[model samples]
Target: MIEEEPRLSAQEMIDRLEPSLSLKRRVRAVAALLAGLAGAVFVSALWWSEPDPLPGRTQLVFALLTVCCLAWAGYGGWLLTRRVPLFATDRVIAAWMGLAASAATTTALAAVAVQRGTGLVPALAVGGLFVAVALVLAVRAHARRRALLRRVRELTGREEK
Candidate 1:
């Protein structure tokens, strides 16, 4: 006769585990919400304080970027609030955020160089370095997530796909 192991629900598992996990998740969710609120405020201030008019297309692009940032931040808050396992998605978000930050920094640096009539070579080099670092970190994050997921599957006796 084969013996079957009982499966515990997420809540039951959490209850059986350390209490600190829930506390940490709740704290993280609150922090995320606060950060999102701050970002929204900052964006609102920038939108309200535009001294010079931007071209229509430029304005549209800015608006879209703003929306995307806000949405991502809001989604982070929502995800954390739901008490979902962050290991599944947090690393992916971090990777994309790193890339986005690198692109934004590169653009800003290029813009400043152009305004100052300075050479772009230095800016490009620095931007490239930042992007490379971001990519490396992202790759590491993904690798860690994969390892963690594998460990989880092993502990749960789940078959690998």
Candidate 2:
């Protein structure tokens, strides 16, 4: 005889199926939401408040960067609130977002250092570190994606022809 799932209210089903989150996970969610929101606000404010005139293209780039961080905040909020079987984080997209953010931050920092007549070496060192980390993440995401595709093909006995 086939066993059937127990009949339960939606809330009961959710409470039963979902395990309690640990402190680390809770902290991560909060950090993501807070940091993402702060980054978006700061970037927008900084650009708008700049005394120097910014080109239209530069304005667009800043706006896009704000949207990127906002997207992350939305994802984090979603992560914190979901109560049932739902989609998990898309790691590849997350990694790419990280890369984009790292690049934008590093470039802005470097530009500021140069503009302020501050030594470029220190800024370059910090920027290089972030870029390196982003590159590693991008590489890992690509590899993981390829491996998953390969595994799927193996399970289906379908060779890529």
lDDT of 1: 0.67
Query: Model 2 over residues 1-161: C-alpha lDDT tens digits?
Result: 99998786644543433334445656776788898899999998998898778887578778878898798887678667854322123446567878887887778778878878997889889888988898898788777656654544554555432
Q: How accurate is candidate 2 locally (lDDT)?
A: 0.70
Candidate 2 Cα outliers beyond 4 Å, as residue runs: 1-35, 38-65, 77-89, 158-161
Ten contiguous residues minimizing lDDT sum, candidate 1: 12-21
Please report the TM-score between candidate 2 and the true structure.
0.57
Clashing pairs in 1: none
Candidate 1 C-alpha lDDT tens digits along 85-153? 544356566677768878777887787788789988899899989999889988888876677566656
Cα-based lDDT at residue 89, candidate 1: 52
Could you estimate the TM-score for every candidate? 0.65, 0.57
Error of model 2, residue 30, in angstroms: 7.3
Q: Pick the candidate with the highest TM-score.
A: 1
